[model samples]
Target: MPDADNYGNPDYPAQLAEMARVLQLHRGPIAIASHVDADGDAVGSVLGLQRALRALGKPAQAFLRVPNYLAFLPEAGEVSPPRAQLEPGTLLVVLDVDSSDPLRVEGVAIPSGAELVLNLDHHGTNSRRADLSIVEPGKAATCQLVKELVDSLGVPWTADIATPVLLGLVTDTGSFRFMNTNGAVLRCAAELVEWGASLSWINNHLSQQPKSHYALLVSVLSSMEFHFSDLVVSAQINQAMLDSAGAGWEEAEAFVNTIRSAQGTELAVLFKDYGDNVKISLRSRGRVSAQAIAVACGGGGHHAAAGATLNLPYLEARATVLGKIEEQLQIDGLR
Candidate 1:
């Protein structure tokens, strides 16, 4: 029960093992720094790990770099940004994120001399900036990975613990609807539900079922254009869409998903004009790795979904992003 041996399969990557080593090395204070506005995946990872670390008598604190969607989860009151820098005996553990500049914590900073117990993500575009980076692209969600860690820790996976992680799993998998979702993900999500993760509540928050919620969708649909024999679909939005929907930048993060939701779109792109540059959002179905398309433009994410923000003028930036997608289309023989 000490390590992953206590859990179902201990899906412990070499990264988790390295985390234990760093814990032992410090054996005193440890800090868990994570992003806030934390979806189920992020909050779950932070909460589960913080609990495990504290159980070991390690001084662990969960830091939120941003405000969470408070209407959604409870990890908020229990969470707050941690003070910058690790204690002399503290080890810093960063989880479930891909940015080195994550948190953009205005006044917060990591101790320049602190040892990092990095739990790097397994995402294809993971930054792997931690001391012990745990990159497990093989796992469907970081929460699933954290659940493995929690199970191996030998403590019961109660609803309080499982709910947060389950939320993350559901969010990341698009409520078990994304193509990345496999039997393993379903099995994991089912277990979380069995462990008391509330699907009804999760669905209420996640599903874009509300008719009023379709404002952004309406905008995307109205602006959408088909290309490449209808295999490629694209849309362009200006700040006007957000103003119309009363959504801020965070709320519009899924703008491209709206475009991709169209039935016949094998590839979908949304170019949101930001004046100086455009935020390029890309999504693809089948074997279309949108991440590759974005990374080609110097951005990255999973194969089907990825994006990049360019500082160039709107038309020029849009041209560059579409050009990359065209290059990919030729490479994939979709053209």
Candidate 2:
């Protein structure tokens, strides 16, 4: 089993110390990776730690591929795609993802030939083991854990290092608007800013979406759906919609957040139809558990946001998801 501890566990500092020691002792190349889809938190965590390791004269590479929207992050272009296999004796650090599942780790069938696999994440649902894992569900983002781990490594903070780390904090907290934006993470953000993290640059890039994004957003909004007396809302995007708007999944990824803002919505769903399967993203407000609904469908995430990919076709998946949400509503006595 992986050595695991929550942030408040008395042993947490010792665990971090040991992880730091492991990284320091490893002379082999270090490969950093995160979940697929390469959201801002994943991209930022990967890039930030990769730069920090390199600064320590450790051979580290970001084993992640990002979406176009995230490509603007500092050093994002330098990241390599996950390989079919890694060099022997490589230390593979998978961040912001459940490291126990190779499928979720992105790019590789399994991390073959890795000497050690370390999982650093903040997902409460993560249950599997890695060689070593520090899972803190209380954290606002994995970047917060990354910041602590980097501190343990004695790596001096720099703009290049701090910027990507801040990217994770900024985006994962929804630019500090999400519920996960706690005091500790806000303090971390302030420290990163002090270390020359370019907050304005990140905000500017994020705010400046392409025209296609607006087109795609418009289409998704037009597909507004309501269930359970407007307590639940949803929208969908299919390949047809993507083609019509000349947009991509990246453009549609955040649409769930849009629909979730509808007044008095308890739950919101964004369904991305891919003909044979549908990807479901869920967001919930107050006492409703989006993660529970997602977990029921074989997906995992935070209380407020989560997702799952269903093998069933769009209509079947839609029915199944709606059923799950209704069941959850009933359980919560909201129906």
Candidate 3:
């Protein structure tokens, strides 16, 4: 059984057992994929599972549209984009992906002959299309759930495995400062530390920004806007700004939190103009639902942190998203 403190469906153990059985019965290679943005939780979950399966003497490969900052992770060099050819009966496991839509996984198509699809995630908006899925929305991070699955499968705990799992928990919980941080989260962190996970190294690497990244942050902050008596704050980054700072989309991660930190701000938004589309990141300080706003804009994510891509000009996208946030605030009587 999963630890009582872990957040998951009551039947998680049974599902995990069945998955193990399937892996034991199959003789084909397993391919793991995750969301493209590849945050710490997403990357950690994918790499951690790959290591665990390999430790079990199973043939496994991992795939992701790798994020540059995460290249330091163990076996990260092995991560690749989805392959065009997969052998028949190959099992495809997707980790930490919030939506079943191919676009959500960065257009990674499921190969023609996959015997089974396993979706391991902690997103409430998951479409549940996998043959077997363990979606635990209450968990702080998918890596946290992955740790539970690893333990239930009796996989050996090694520093290689524990490091990534701890990375996921730390980043997803904002260094254990997010609202989801709970007793189980702390306990899991303590256990991982005991298993040789280095908290200081993880925190330093994640928090240390390059000079260019700080420049990008300055540009974004310079464009900040406030609305609804500063209850809703927004900042935008254009390709020009990114070029000036010599930065990319990954460098802009967590920049929205700066906006959210402003006093009286209940909702914060970061809009990144990616030429063809604008990616909108939403963050909330409890009074509004970021997930609701993202979903209304044809995107999905957690209640506190959500994102959507708008196929519109920068100004149009900003207006559309702000309109939705305002509507949600009105409905919730926050305006």
User: Candidate 1 vs candidate 2: which has greater lDDT?
Assistant: 2
Clash count of each predicted structure? 7, 0, 0
TM-scores of the models, in the order given: 0.82, 0.96, 0.94
| Candidate of highest TM-score | 2
Model 1 residue 241 CA deviation in Å: 2.8
Residues 79-149, model 2: lDDT tens digits: 88878888878898989888877768884446456889888899988774889988888888999889999
Pick the lDDT winner.
Answer: 2
lDDT for 124 in candidate 2 is 85
Off by over 4 Å in 2: 1-8
Writing each residue's lDDT as its tens digit, candidate 1 over 175-199 gives 7788768777777778888988798
How accurate locally is residue 279 in candidate 3, as Cα lDDT from 0 to 100?
Answer: 94
Q: Which residue pairs in candidate 2 collide? A: none
How well does candidate 1 score on lDDT at residue 13? 53
Candidate numbers sorted by lDDT from highest down: 2, 3, 1
